[model samples]
Target: MTTLDLDFVRSHFSAFNEPSLAGWSFFENAGGSYACNQVIDRLTNYYRKTKLQPFHPFPASEQAGREMDAAINNLAAYLNVDEDEIDLGPSTSQNTYVLAQAFLSIMQAGDEVIVTNQDHEANSGAWRRLTDRGIIVREWRVDPETGYLDIAKLDKLLNDKTRLVTFPHCSNIMAHVNPVAEISAKAHAVGAKVVVDGVSYAGHGFPDVDALGADVYLFSLYKTYGPHQGLMVVRKDTREALGSQGHFFNEGLVHKRLVPAGPDHAQVAASSGVTEYFDAVHAHHFGPQADASKRGPDIHDLFQAHEQVLMAPLLEYIRSRNDVRLLGPENPEERAPTISMITNRDGRSVAEDLSKHGIMAAGGHFYSHRLFQGLNLDPEAGALRVSFVHYTSPADIQKLLKAMDAVL
Candidate 1:
């Protein structure tokens, strides 16, 4: 099997060689990754050459419209979803907020929606707020000790009245990869729709939405090393079921329906760069391929294999430490590269100390306050999160281990 070419991977991201960023090991990728040159070039070119009112009957406008359409089509192909099923919006928080409005129009009083504490506030708060409209918002809480969501608990919560179930593909803090297909299957059996927040998971690999079987899937492009846009896929049946949130004229357009705010043409156009980066990776390892869908899994496995190797030593180190509590599974195979730890010392101070040695990481509740409270962690103190992606090298991990030793 072909392995990931790390040299080929790091070369695509200009940030690695920046004068000010030299020698700095970036582990805050879950917050947002350093964009690849493909994204930067596309974004910059869009602004310079094709900045115009897209879809208009003119030269620049036509080019702008084509670029935006290519972005959606290419990305949709990679996910194995129809282009019409995809919606690009400002951010994941904004996308879910708008989507909640559509759900509100359909859900009747006494109907239940289950949300997980393991989710970021972007996914949890929006659905929970629907309780104001008389919908019964139920909490599918995570295990207080392990920070893992139990499907058995979810099974108890689902019933005839359960209209929707919202959870993460993986938690930003816990990093445990959820069984999205299995969870979606259970929800489907209960006649409920599954809304997946893929922001954390997509940084490791973009999912095959069709196979995952979610009614609605969402991820942020910025965190995926693309533009700052939220990409959502609403299955055809789910799109038709929800009331339109867009303007009256766009009611019949599946892509336009949930986006109340008009699309950002330039950013949408630049998003094609994400697929460009993926294609480059696929070609470098496995040779040129015309099929984006086929390439998706191959590339995903390659990246995950590389990440797991780098993640193993870090997981072992965290498990051996008695001074801090590791948040999720100690095995790297069970999670993404996003690792969190709660310490006796202040998390923020530890993060600051790590920064002095040029290790870029973050410390916070990460907007999952309810999850923190459930885990018996002080939300005010939060926890230290050290996350990375495929571009991260073994040498970088060594620097992080040394910095962590000195700081903690």
Candidate 2:
């Protein structure tokens, strides 16, 4: 695979050149990423030219509809799934909540579903509520020391009665990249479907959703250099068995089945910019491909290769520190670049100290309070998070280390 061109990648994000954002290294990417220039330009263009309702015969309306369709198709191509299998909702929280209702529709009083402490609340909360409906909600917990969900533990949790299994592709706090394909295979053998939450993982690079073999996949577009939209991919085969949460009139449409609320028009239309941006990066590094779908794995490798390099020095620095405790896998290769540490002070105060040195980071439970509880830590205090993605440069990492020396 071709190496990632950092300067070229940085050029695609306007935030790097923004006056107020200058001199600051961003480490809060797990919260949300800076939208690339393509997404931004598409957003502004939509607002300026096609502010009208879409799919009508009038020019602006027709153009608006075209953009929206293109967005879905292009994004689907990159995800390696059918166009109708994709749903773009308001956010991951909303998408998962409505989806749980669909799951509930197909479930019985004593049906069993599995959940995890290692997942963000968006992925865990709505499903947990099924307990009120008489569904057996079993907890597949993380290893407190590693903050990772063990596949062996999942094996123990799985049996003939297992209906569904929901877990994160990577933990936001620990950053351990779960073996999704392996987990999916185990779940399938027990006649269960797996909902893989790719929110914390997708931003680093878009995985081959089809290859992961998940029955359903979810991720946040806002964190993937696109608009504030949540993407849910319900495979053609799996969605056939699930119930719809959409309007009775729209039950025929697969994409509309899970999204109960109306989508944001401009945001949906502008989302094509994400694929456009990815195409540019691919062309820059590995030249052109006839299909964007084919580029998913290669692009994933390119981005992850770059990110792993960025992770090396920081992991080394954290290893040398006696005062700092790094959560998740110690090896950068085993996890995402989202590093969280617990120190003497509370996470918030330490984040405040780091901010004084122009390092952009935050400290909080980050909606993984259950994971903290599993680890015997105070959710209110939380851990300081310093995360980065492919766009993060060596200079930015160095800047962070220099500030770490001062603050820690």
Candidate 3:
């Protein structure tokens, strides 16, 4: 099993040394990961040097544009998709909204869309709006007790009318990792497109979008230890069907088609930092054998193995606690490192108590209202979410457990 180098990770993050926040063990990585110092340094240097508008006629602007393009291409390669298939947006929420609008032109009245109650509002609300246009919205509900989506029930929900199916690759609230390959195959068998909300899964490891058979996959860069931006991959064939939401002049620009909003140049430039951090982690653990040049399945597997080892103890501990009700699978194999749980008391109170003890954690619906509702959790009460990334240490988990003992 691969063990995380805590000393090496701590050195990479300056936040660990802050005296006032000495006890603060951040466990809210599912919402947003702490930016790596290497990533921050690159962004700071870029800001100091150029900070000019990209894609212009000037040499400096052209170079800046090339850097941004390289970032997009790198991310696309990681996702196992062509360069033209990728699009960068301000946030996952914005990307979904834009995708919904793009589908509006192609979807006729009475066409159906399949959505899961286990998704974040970003995935649900955008597609749900189709109800206004006489488009049928079918909800695949999760089992209240297990918080698992009933794929067999989904078999009943799909039909010829189904044009698109939206679900989370891994839910933020339930912390359930859906079987994307299985579900995608089912959706494809019926001629429906699969759209996966990958924000939660992406932090644990990069996924192969093509292998998952998702027509479109969306994730937030902020949650993956990079800049606050959204990364979206739409299959080239699907991109051809969706009409441009941008200006009339840019209709042929496939990347800008679904995104009505223009790109954030600096954030786009900074996104390469995520790949940089991943490369560093791979090299640290596996030595120079880490091939940063490779993408897709191989790199994703390497990262996933690293994360699984780091998260094992936390999952085992949560399973042993009768006082805690875990939202998803008790088994680590069925989920990501995001541990969502409900205690005997209000989750927010538990979070505050943890904070007082110098543990950085959070409690709330995490914008996954539908999921909380499906699980019969009060949106206001929420659930305590303790998530970890590749850089998270075993010591951090122990610190969180120690805090939990005092709070619970």
- TM-score each candidate: 0.99, 0.99, 0.94
After superposition, the stretches of candidate 2 with alpha carbons farther than 4 Å from their true spots are none
What does candidate 1's lDDT look like per residue over 216-252, in tens digits?
Answer: 9999999999999999999998889899888999888
Clashes of each: 0, 0, 1
lDDT of each: 0.92, 0.92, 0.83
Off by over 4 Å in 3: 1-3, 17-20, 287-299
Give the Å shift of residue 175 in candidate 2: 0.6
145 Cα displacement, candidate 2 (Å): 1.6
Q: What is the lDDT of residue 240 in candidate 3?
A: 91
Model 3 has a clash total of 1
Ten residues in sequence with the least summed lDDT for candidate 2: 254-263
Model 2 Cα displacement at 159 (Å)?
Answer: 1.2
